[model samples]
Target: MSLNDIDNVVEAFVKGARVASKSGFDGVQLHAAHGYLIAQFISPKSNERTDGYSSRPENALRLLKRIVSAIRSVVSKDFVVGIKINCADYTDDHDRHALVLDHFRTIAAWGEVDFIEVSGGDYEKPDFLATQTRSPRQALFSHFSRTAMDAIESLKQESTLSAPLPLILLTGGLRTPELLHTALAARHAHLLGIGRTSILCPDLPRLLKEMEKETREVGTASSEAYWSSPFRPEPDLTFSPIIRNLVPTIPLVGAGIGTAWYVVTFRRLAAPPTSKGMSFEPDYNLGPLGAVFWMWIWVDTRPTSGMKVCRRRLSPIGIVTAAFHARWPKSPLCKTLMEYERQILGLKLEAGSLGLKETLAGREVYTHVGWLALVSGAGISASTTYIGIVRSGLPALIHERVTSTPADWNAFLTMVRDININDIREGAAELRAASQRERLMEERIQAMEVQCGIRAAPRDLYY
Candidate 1:
């Protein structure tokens, strides 16, 4: 994990590659894109050390150089050595925009590398690298790739002065045949990297080739003709790229209704006393149906009031609130709310109980939702109890949680619903009471400090 452990990391990779070659694979592409370990070191935002690896751009390239050198030493010269590199860093300081050309130029200089496939974005910028769904802004979606390609093209042109052209592979947002052909014709890109599209239409390349031949000999193919092709096989996969792309556009109520139905049906079938055991048979059949039903209702109802919030705001807080409810179902509603507030918002309601504090601080909200649902028995009957808990404690929770960071107040409200009856039985009253007691103690300490000139000292000071 530490960059200091480079020697061991390199040895392990080299060893793995040797094993793979021995097993008869053609070659290996060192996956350095998408903010992986190598990409992390190359990126300025992630690599902040004062050592040789962080001092300069060339230093950043050290790990990559070492890896290529090691691989070359073991593999045959004829064996392909390719790399998947990010075109640009989507994050602020790590923005690969300015230095991307230089980086490509440096990599191109390395004689050992045979091919370079370009990609973009880091973990922080999920939209650029991991966007699986469609948006109105199709051009913006491929921003990273576009930027990277521009840089690569500049490098390609410059390199021609000294030597032959470099083989550059372009990936991302290449869903259409026209776009691919245009890029190739313009000499901006040499190879097309098909990802999710290939998964959608595996034989797309073959189909496109046929389409190209038909167009050259006769004329442009009509849409009806394309769809009527008897040679086209039925897709074995149910989730097509089009469907996957459309999912994010599904309304919140639709998603919620789908979730609610599954919870209810599965809760009954997978009920603890079932003879069928806790298998997913019931879930599998009913879950998709529930999802479809919800999606349908979402489309029909077309309610815009509560469904417009982004997933990032909802998912994280929803998880934390769910966890709190599950963990402390028998606890006072106030305690559950306080736990959520502290965990997701980092607003400490109680000063003691390091376990609760640490758990709240470290655990993401969405993750806690399952724990809350499971322990609280809020699975199917979440609507009944969730409301009362929120009504009684939400004000304090919001006041505490949102003081420092402003979150979508509406999304926070939407996450809470009625708790299931089962959750009420599993409630943790003792823990809630303990948390309340801790809050009182802290309050008393603060009052004492103000009144009697008494103050708590840091543990480090005592040490």
Candidate 2:
């Protein structure tokens, strides 16, 4: 960034800290980790600038130092200011790694900072996501955290400040309570951080408290006692091994896809309760394909509300059909479209009707029309006329071919046994034939109208 840009950037951080304090936050942590903008400037692998920010290692930290000072000027002493820096970027070079650690020690020496949260890796080597399972024999990031603590301790002894040393927070691979307790006890890190595990078990702290009570009653104290207590963390899902093997592993596809899965889950958890009901449950069953689909398509992510028929946008032909139907409701085209819509809706209601009926047999079936926007307003006739085409006629055709014996999710192959390529081909052929016949009839009618003087002939024909 230019000199002017740097000034604006620092000012923005100061403003953010000010707002955070005023808004009743405990502290603001500057994210100079995980290949972000500030982290980019700190990493020699990425930063190629000849500016003051990149001239030397100390100068590389100049941006963060400026922000810390600016924040201190605005917020109270009680308002904690922490910086999350990389333990080291993914590099094999010892000198480069040492330089990165030195940058961390330098920040710790600065008295204004309250805490330093150490996290490693970036988009290139995203061990930061911690989605992959590491070998139980070797702990993740334990060595790095220990070395970082030693560096901090060395800085504290050299400094003349009488205040306590800044706390070190180690994040990544702190899944089990056993590992967390061990990390703290060993002084590997003063604090610990959790990520994906928290999403899987939101009430983990409460669960742990309950386990501690049970274990105490059993006269057991070891962390392993809780392992048999019926409260184990759910295995976090990711791409299948087949997919992993298919892609080049160096730029790990699982890391990116796994992150997307977590992101989609976050959105689901944050969404407010709809008119039908709230779907607070995390979709753990969501596969890699569904993850990409939901991430890109907004409408698909929207939870299927009540058992009502949902409609989608009408195609160009569908709009014309609707208009023609509205003008002549008794016409063959109008009648045929109406019949198609009714048949499709019947199929939908039948397919999803069983499970709900068995559970809520007597209760009224509440229909939800989520796609009302497309099927309403001044063009209501045009929209409603093509209701059969909701998300394509493929769904209706598939439903027709499949058995009406209610869905058996366990026997997924059985449920889709009848929906073969032949059925799909037949459906497409029928649709094409119908569209061609309709177009020809429409042209013939227009010509007949002009000859009978029911409609004026084109003046250009005589010219």
| lDDT (10s digit) by residue, model 2, range 1-463 | 8879988889778878876776579999999988998888887878888888882776888888999999999788899999887765734678766886787677776788888887777888766766433432125367777877898788756747666667888776666667677788898898887777677666778877986686677755564666433333443554578876776766457666776677667656555656565435677688777876666554323333332223332222433344445555654432344454444344333332211211122332222233333335433333233223222323456656443333354454566566778877876787677567645554444333322323333322221
| Per-residue lDDT over 252-329 for candidate 1, one digit per residue giving the tens place of the 0 to 100 score | 433344345443343333224445443323333444445445423431122223233222322224434444455556
Off by over 4 Å in 2: 133-140, 219-252, 271-281, 298-463
> Once superposed on the true structure, which residue ranges of model 1 sit more than 4 Å away at CA?
1-4, 90-96, 128-165, 221-463
Positional deviation of 147 in candidate 2, in angstroms? 1.6
Model 1 — which ten-residue stretch has the worst lDDT? 352-361
Q: Which one wins on lDDT?
A: 2
Residues forming the 10-long window of minimal summed lDDT in candidate 2: 352-361
